[model samples]
Target: MSGSFGGQSAGGAKKARIEIIPLIDVIFFLLATFVLFTLSLDKIQSVPVDLPQATPAARPITEDDLVVLQISEPGTAYWNRELISSTEIPRRLLDYKATVPAPRVLVSGDDKARYGDAVLALDEVRKAGITVSIETAFRATGR
Candidate 1:
């Protein structure tokens, strides 16, 4: 039973078409959001400078004492006498801290090294839940 119009044909409903304009807009918005977020992360940039001098009493660093972290030339770093990438520092420190009885860290940076690298190392170590202390060499005073 159908309409008796001039030439009427009856069939099922038509399929809906996807609108690409809105999809493109959404993709663009996501791209913009990601770009903005990445740009904002630069605010965490580290400062480069020689730390102030302090007169510290002679304290012996026993074998079980502070763990050493060194930043050497050519962008190489060492943790506890092991060579590891900078990104791996935090995870390694966490693992080390879990096993060590007294977990302490000392960051010693080369004077010729980039200060940002040193700060980043320190930040990672601190985030790993270990106490951090920076090493400063004190020159002998003339009598």
Candidate 2:
């Protein structure tokens, strides 16, 4: 009766076996749940713009023929993430209009930005002579 060292259960050789079916089932369940949870979510892609809210209406019709013009609070302007002088916008828009047909433009001005700065950006767009849409956030009213 060697206590535990040589003690063998009355059954034959006890081989340590790792059961993996339960682990696989749990992994699959978690993966499936995560995918299903995010499947119904709408993707809202945009540059960070602290835009003033307005009535829910038409949104920017983003497409391949689109140019995003952003004006920051410091009066700095960007063209699709590329820093560009406000003076450069007109030239660039003219160049694009020459190569492309009917390019759409979206102008986004920060809420804290100077009113003159927003007007200046819009003015540049106007000078370019391309149809421009002012981008704004949707403020829901009465639920």
Candidate 3:
């Protein structure tokens, strides 16, 4: 025998209902957390420059002996991090040569930069009799 209150059985229980709004909020919060976490894990160590694409693949260089030479569209030149004039290239290369035999210099020219600017940079390096190479992006093989 069951007791009745207001014409309803007292022993009967109501079905539990899930609040969809709160569940959706919890899911969005988790999604945001993962997105922020993934973005923080990527570390990019590179100078801002637009590299030109080339048919030849880019060669990987790990030797610390290699020096970075950056040439922008406005004819600005930077050796490693120090900005220098075109006239200063030979002097700097010579100074480096005295310490390291057969110094290898990597010239990174902006895609929008004048071709003559790159030539001028290379000319100075050649004048100093140093081996120099250019940095280029390898052509993408697939879509």
RMSD after CA superposition, every candidate = 20.5, 15.5, 15.3
- Candidate 1 lDDT, 1-143, residue by residue in tens: 66444444355445457999999999999999999999888566788999889766456556676777876554567676666667777787888888886688978765555688889888888788788988775212110
Please give the lDDT score at residue 26 for candidate 2: 96
Number of backbone collisions per candidate: 0, 0, 0
Clashing pairs in 1: none
TM-score of each prediction: 0.48, 0.48, 0.47
- What is candidate 2's lDDT per residue for 1-143, written digit by digit as tens? 43334434545455566899999999999999999989978999979979887666365444667887777656367687777766677788898788767777878765545678778778877887888899786312111
Could you tell me which residue pairs clash in candidate 3?
Answer: none
Write the number of the candidate with greater lDDT, choosing between 2 and 3: 3
The CA lDDT at 28 in model 1 is 100
